[model samples]
Target chain A: MATQASLDNPPQVPSQTSSTGRGFPTGLAVLTGFTGVMLLAASYMVFVYAPMERTLGNVQRIFYFHVASAWAGALAFLVALVAGIVFLINGKMQWDRVGKSSVEVGLMLLTITLTSGPIWGQYAWGNPWPAWDPKLTSAAVTWLSYAAYLMLRQGIDDPRRRARFAAIYVIIAFTSVIFTYVGVRFVEQTIHPHVVGPSASTGEGDFGVSARIGQTLGFSLLTFTAVYATLLAHRLRLENLSERIKQVKSAVLARQG
Target chain B: MTDRVEAETAQSTRRTLKPTPLAQATLAIAWKDLRSELRRRELVAAMLVFALLSLLIFSFALEVDARSRAANAAGILWVTLVFAGTLGLGRSLGRERDQGSLEGVLLAPIDRSALYFGKLIGNFLFMIIVAVIIIGPLSVLFGISLFTPLLPLILLLGILGYAGVGTLVASLAAYTRGREILMPILLLPIALSILIPAVRATRAVLEGAAYSDITIWLNLLLATNVVYIVLAYLLFDFIVSE
Candidate 1:
């Protein structure tokens, strides 16, 4: 349990060097810059380069970022799932950190996918929210599953036990994410567009993709993937720093006693 | 004290008893739970009452036209079963935690997964009992026929998957604060995967859809059961570790 004294009197983070005695890596900086540039270019391609749909017109442009963010969200969860397995096998705290950070990033990206999805859906489906669509319902379920993952983490105070329990949970929760991405496509009743390969012919929002739209979709995916990586790296660093601060605080408490 | 004598005799029997095989150990734990429940009769009774009460509410909540009743039957039954199942799961595990028996169970010579399977079996049986008892009233109240040959098979698979995951999660929640409330929050979303298909399959069965039409859902329910049971087997040890 965290004591009120330690909570109120927090340790100051060293400005120049981390507890590792290192500054930010050049590789991360370069990746950050590259992601920024790619994001700008991807936006240009989405709004300017990709041709407006024959029917959906300008509203169809949301598809590029929508699918890209969803792709990034799924990728982040995949990373967490792998991190969870490794953490359980090796009992490594760093792997636990990676798993936690990835889920946080994944949840953020999923929120974007879910919220932006409804906006486009309002125009494409004439309903901002369609409860019957398997794609949307499963995505909501996936979101709730990960949200519960965070709540589970919050309820446990022991670090190692928390990490172990979280690893077990995140791995189990990945099923919902898989269902959202792949399993729902098998359902014949969903009206959500299946932009990927051959889907059931029953979807109402299905559209034909042209050459430029495909290019922009690909670039947006790359940019969002980069964004996921950048956010995860920064979140991991923050986690590491907070862990160090806890160590220092506990040491100070022992000295005072 | 008589309590000390009981503990001493229990320890003596354990010393005389050799380590049982995994299946035997699992059955012993499951039987212990069943025997205890049989004597007390509270857990299943509460669950049965809850299940029937919800059925009563649903009969009025949905328009009870003969046509709509069949259409609404599947959803109402699953929802009733899941809520009742959650209540039963929480109580079963909460009893172990409250009595400090889980630690004693953990100290046994059996494998951790034996403990998991034991609890799963007990929970599965409770769910089956409540599910069976509810169907009679549900059919009578809704004025529909539900005695199809295949319905029990679907109920078995669905409850297997539900109880498998529910036991694992209830154990997790048992150690936390306000575990009573936390049980449903953590369990329900993951349960959606299982419940949706169960409801769909049941709807098809009720509507007299061909076996061909229902095979997809039945297959999915079986696959989910296999996955959850395997995952629970692999992961249960981590939860029980000191």
Candidate 2:
């Protein structure tokens, strides 16, 4: 059993050095550059190409990036959920790293979604914060849930135990994400419009998306996915470096003693 | 030698065929908690007094007249329950940690799910007792009779859901450095999903709405209760494991 445990978690020194020496792989750099260009193009399409809506006019352009960010946030959370489950099942530190990094990025993107949502709401619905909006409320709730997950992580000291608790928590928190996406529709009345699915309702401030607008939305979502991937890779590398530093510091202290 | 081997095989087979010890362990743990509570009366007293005081504060803050109180009764009831229930939950687990009894419990030869369900039952019972105590004062103070049979049923479903998630979260929080402060922060957002439907159902029942009108919320409450209980049961082992 001891031999198996050691073999499973072989000394981390060589791999860390080799990866760090490579210093930012070409793939990631290319992906980041591609994402930057696509994001710029998407913005141009939103401003110059898509026709102005008769209802909300040019302010409706925010919907393209706003909805794209929401989608990306949900997708990131889903990645965290999957990674969490895998970590719990396999007890792998790499999976935990993936889960934590994804959650951080997801939380940042969701903040953008939540903030942009109100700006759009103010111009479109004439209320900066519509109390009865189901989508808005659900987004707020999901954001709080993940924020709690991060806070819980901060309070635990043992890396293994922290990862374990976070794994269980993110899995549980994913249910709230699902609820935010679908639960509002179950309530009797909601002012938030459903842009997709069979139960899409034309609520206040909803406008028809022309073909050009749809293209822009799709392009923006794809660009955000690329950005999410690049960010997650960089965050994972940072965590590995930090872990390596801790190991080296402990080894040096032992030698000095 | 053959006779002895045959006898050993028979005993091992009989042991394998017997029912698991899970049910008995769950009951024993729950009974132990209740008996301890009966002797000390600590958790229940705090929860009850805190709940009553919350009602007092809400009344003053809202300046709730009889009509307005009636309208806000459901929201008031759930808010009071959540705050009081959180207090009870934190104290209940915090005691085990403070006394170092949690380690002993884990060391016992029992399944972890049994420990989880045991805590769930104990927490559920405490919340229900507090809810029952608050009903009388709520009735007299708000000038509305809140003693309907349906009200208790709704409270039971709601408290079950709350306690299901609460017991698991409390155990997790109890291990943290900021156990007391972290419990509510971790609990409230997740519990909100359960509380929303519960508050809706309670309001419908309070207003004497038709059964059909409130059925959906009741169903939601039941679903949330079962989902949380099962999920917590399956996941408790992970949280408690080293």
How close to the true structure is residue A161 of candidate 1, measured as C-alpha lDDT? 90
Error of 1 at A129 (Å): 2.7
Q: Please give the TM-score for the first chain of candidate 1.
A: 0.87
Query: For candidate 1, lDDT tens digit of each residue in B38-131?
Result: 9999999999999999999988878878676666899898999999999999976789889877767766656778888988999999999999
Give TM-scores for every candidate, taking all chains together and pairing residue i with residue i: 0.92, 0.91
- Cα lDDT tens digits for candidate 2, A1-257: 65455446544443443465347777768878888898888878889988888989888888888888888898899999999999989998888888999999999889889988888888888898877466777788889999999888988899999998998888777775554346535755777776665444657876777788788888888877877888888787787777777775565445444
DockQ of each: 0.63, 0.52
| Model 2 residue A188 CA deviation in Å | 3.1
- Winning model by lDDT: 1
Q: Return the TM-score for candidate 2, rounded to 2 decimals.
A: 0.91
Candidate 1: segments with Cα more than 4 A from true spot = A1-27, A179-181, B1-18
Query: For all the models shown, what interface RMSD does each have?
Result: 1.5, 1.4
Cα lDDT of candidate 2 equals 0.80
